[model samples]
Target chain A: AQSVTQLDSHVSVSEGTPVLLRCNYSSSYSPSLFWYVQHPNKGLQLLLKYTSAATLVKGINGFEAEFKKSETSFHLTKPSAHMSDAAEYFCVVIRSPGKLTFGTGTRLTIIP
Target chain B: EAGVAQSPRYKIIEKRQSVAFWCNPISGHATLYWYQQILGQGPKLLIQFQNNGVVDDSQLPKDRFSAERLKGVDSTLKIQPAKLEDSAVYLCASSSGLPGLATNEKLFFGSGTQLSVL
Candidate 1:
């Protein structure tokens, strides 16, 4: 089954520094992948998605993910981290007809 | 536009009790889903409904779990004889198009209902 693995369970970055959340995927074929973020007491919001379009996908809030098939990875990156970026982020991959498998999640912390 | 709506932001019940969670998807959405997120883990799908019909419930524990979308707009998930392990956040989501079947489709989510089963 298609699934994604978030290499880091928690990532901490100083404010204004670059942010990188690593994610590796396992699938026999090219798959649809997504990045979702959840804030405290809020819904999970879509960050971005890769649907076999351009290898590089830009999403809301200055976030982007590059689909690297050769490396089987779709890592989320931001040029500069902000305090508001602290939250739990999930990596999702569509497996079956209605199945979207989610990784354990990566909690991002922004240090002042 | 209004996002998915879920009721009772929090619930606390003893094990073996029965509890139900309600959800109202965005107007005009055809697909609704229920997911359970345990602390420190990602959300897991419980059931899915497409226009008042069951699309998927493979992961739902049918023994004590049940869900329904009667009018195809609002949904309810019930857990009878809740277990200690049932403590988690119940999330409701809706999409205008088929979710996993369509690669580009997106889902609107609710804040979720936190259930604490003692």
Candidate 2:
């Protein structure tokens, strides 16, 4: 069985400050991890993915995530926060082909 | 490259009523998925299809929830005799190949149909 746990339900950060959203996973096999972002009334868009290739994965909009096998963690981060970054973030784990188990999402709020 | 397309962006029905949602994946996408997302929660996979064949539907409520992708290009999910708990956003996603086979392939999602059961 494979599952992901997002550590925070909601996170608030000031503009120009750094941002971090934590996630942990449990997978029996080598797992593929992904971070997706969803704005209000919009569908999910892929931010980044890790497939046993690179531990530090960079994504669109200056967002990135690091895959830590030892820690069972894949935490998403950004160098600085922007107003447009406010959205719901989901951490997903896929152990088998075409099967994805998603975490309970983290809501990010950007403060001006 | 057009994104996945879904219909009935919003729907409202009474409990025990039936509803259906449709999806059209991006061109050349061979895999499709249906997910249920409740308020404040992540999207949960209800079913998956490869072309016109069913791949995984272990989590779908078979008694009342059914889906089909007749031509493998478009799909439909139907919920008969809906329950109050079924009120949520239904998202349709598609990928070019079997997901894990390629590391760079990602699921493209539609805006989703929001179902509200009264």
Highest TM-score against the true fold, candidate: 1
* Residues A5-111 of candidate 2: C-alpha lDDT, one tens digit per residue: 99999999999999999999998877889999999989899999998888999999999999998999999999999999999999998757767788999999999
lDDT of 1 by residue, B8-115 (tens): 999999999999999999999998999999999999999989889998999999999999999999999999989999999999999877644675578888999999
**Candidate No. with top DockQ:** 1
How good is the docking of model 1, as DockQ? 0.62
For every prediction, compared with the true complex, DockQ reads 0.62, 0.61
lDDT of 2: 0.93
Instruction: Give fnat for candidates 1, 2 and onward, in order.
Output: 0.64, 0.61
Q: Tens-digit lDDT track for model 2 on B15-103? A: 99999999999999999999999999999999999999998999999999999999989999999999999999999999988734864
